[model samples]
Target: MDRSLILGLLIFLTLLAMPFALPLIGQGYLTGLIIKAMLLAIAAISLDLLIGHGGLVSLGHAAFVALGAYAAAIALQSGIENILVLLLITLALTGFVALITGSLALRTTGVYFLMITLAFGQMAYFTLTSLAAYGGDDGLTLWSLATLFGSNVVQKGNGLYFIVLGTLLASWWFVNRMSQSRFGRVLRAARDNPERTEVMGYSVTRYRLVAYVIAAMIAGVSGLLVMQHAEFVSPALAAWQRSGDLIVVVVLGGLATRNGAILGAFFLVIVEELLGSFIHEWRLIYGPLLVFMVLFAKGGLSDLLTSKRRGNQVA
Candidate 1:
């Protein structure tokens, strides 16, 4: 019944009830918004694995999402309809690319690593744009949603919603476990003190490369969901601006906390929606809000919420 577990439980219940609750509130259009947030949260959480735990700041993380989406579109284009098969292909493709890029990127640290990731990302974006057969610069559209076990379950009512919710929960749990494992310890130690960790016999480069691959695979899964949800795969998914937003989501949520990504995703998407609705020039306000958060809320909203709970408990 501690704060962390309580927070986790609250998130779980809220998501579980969203589909039903949103409809009753006559704001069911928000369901799509929630799904978008959840999917983005998955990507953001994966990025957090690198940023928070591995201390790697990748500016091109969105490339993996675009890769996943393209993988799905390409697979379907090639006559593949099985959701499982598409996901496997997508994850494998993402893993392969991540391994190759990570091997090279991990050779450098700090700003060099960040820049290399960005380069790889842009390479992916341009490559997608050049794919004329699949819509290229205009992007490709799925004829329909991928079938699960030969059924249109994903295209049916609330089926995709529930599936996405399940995936998000599983991802949150998996990342949480990963952050608490011995491997997690090695990653954190390497992050805090690479030389000492290297002297202790752990291969820092290999650890980071593995983390990068895992994060990429997770982002790929989110891409799968995105393609299903949007029925469109565009090079825009791999744009540097998207990657920057993912980073913003991670930092905005409170780096290092298991639920921070989720909280940040909800906050970012909701705020954007509010601003877009109320102001013609939303970025003017949104940009400053991010700067304020970075300057004043070092731990992000997750930390802000937990602090209040701690104060209440102490009293």
Candidate 2:
């Protein structure tokens, strides 16, 4: 097998072993932290599919996440409590929204595209805040936890952790497969040279729109998992700041690297947890930290770590 496959397997094994080793480490706190990291990792991975692979920088990705969360929450409230049903509803709603918004957003490019996406995301947030039936800005709580195959699967911490791990693994595999597929090649080609791709008879906008919708759908799955884990949904999920944070997580992990998203999520969440313990104003630190990251580590945390290995191999 190739080095990337071996590396991916190693990461999967580590995630699988985490829950088993948590109690022995006297650090059950780490388990919850890992779970949250995995959740964000899923989101980052989906965003990476667009930003890193498709060369589509979206600032409104969080809107789909919020849409998924609200879809699941509202469905559960309306007596649709099965996890599968909730997931289906969330995916469909998020995809629909993406389809509509992506068509319009794709009309612009570069900075204009970024601003349009940001605007749409803000609109979604405000719309959620207006839903007084769901507690508006206060958010809405799930009357009951989601049922998986008629069982309360999420009630078990290990069960929930494993489920998320499984999803992450699946997502990673799916992305890798897509990256190697014909469609993925075309998308990457477009990213490299859109004018040439257009001249080659490919509708660049159409391809990008599809990629945007797919990314949103994947993000929707992450949203479903978030609601299931927290048993709550709110406008906070859709906030523009949340979208910014997601972008940060993706970039900090590394652009164009599959594992970077997961690594970035883990790193950022751990840093937040550690810093927040010592300083109540942790974001004060986070702000500058992000600046330094973007300014210095252009390739991301993973790239910095692997640079020596790459150089050695080249030498």
Candidate 3:
């Protein structure tokens, strides 16, 4: 089997077993931690589609996450409790925002595009903070967890955890298929050399716009899961720092690999949990570690792990 495939399977199995296995080791309480990692992974995966494939680095992608969370939370407050309805509404809002922002952001390249996206993200963050009806700067807490067909299915046991796991798996599969499709090919080609791709008759901007919107919608899904899990919505979810962390996940995991997001999220969460458990000044160590990891781990953990496997196979 391909080394990457083997690694992917191992990661999937570990996540699938976490809800059961953690209890055996007395770490069952970490179920929520793992679920949170998976939820964040969804956002990382969505961001990867842009940074890794389309060569777009968005500093405001977390805005979509906040948008999705707030959209669902607001709906629930208005007496909408169905998860399906909430998800649909979340995606629509995220997509609309992505479309509007992406259309304008795509007109610029490199730093300008990055800045424009960042500006849009700040706009979103402030907009949410100004909505006094929704708790404004203080944030809004959901009255209850999201429901499925009028039942608290998602709130029961590992239901939401498994739901997030399944969604992550499905998203990974979808992104894999997309990365192999003709559209993926064009997007990648454009990323590597826009001039040549345009000469080949592909509209680089159009492909990028589509990818951006897709990514934003996926991030929206992550937001919904986050809101469901935390039972709260705040402007902090859309903060620039959250967006920075999403980028860190992508870069920390390895760019362009389907497994990067999953691996990175797990690694990040574990490191933070471990360090924060002991050190009050954890970021002092964590910050330097990230810089070193990016400096030495060229393709991040995913590529490093897969390459080691391939090397062992060759041996």
- Global CA lDDT computed for model 2: 0.85
lDDT of 2 at 100: 96
**Comparison by lDDT, 1 against 2, better one:** 1
For candidate 1, the TM-score is 0.96
Per-residue C-alpha lDDT of model 1 across residues 1-315, encoded as one tens digit per residue: 567768978998998898899889898888899899999999999999999889999999999999999998899889899999998999999999999999999999988899999999999999999999999899998786799888998864589999899889988998989988998899988988899999999999999999999999999999999999999999999999999999999988877786889999999999999999999899999999988987887777788888642210000
- Per-residue lDDT over 220-303 for candidate 2, one digit per residue giving the tens place of the 0 to 100 score: 998988888887899999988888888899888877675778889989998999999999999999889999987887778667
lDDT of each: 0.90, 0.85, 0.89
Better of 1 and 3 by lDDT: 1
Better of 1 and 2 by TM-score: 1
Candidate 3 TM-score to native: 0.96
Better of 2 and 3 by lDDT: 3
lDDT of 1 at 108: 90
Residue by residue across 1-315, what tens digits does model 3's lDDT show?
A: 767778888889988888899999998999988898998899999998999888888999999999999999999899889999999999999999899999999999888888999999999999999999999999998778789998886865699889999889988888878987999999888988899999999999999999999999999999998999998899999999999999999888888886888899989999999999999899999999988996787777887777652110000
Question: Which ranges in model 2 have alpha carbons more than 4 Å from their true place?
Answer: 308-315
Cα lDDT, model 2, residue 267? 90
lDDT of 2 at 277: 99
Backbone clashes per model, in order? Answer: 0, 0, 0
Runs in model 1 deviating more than 4 A are 308-315
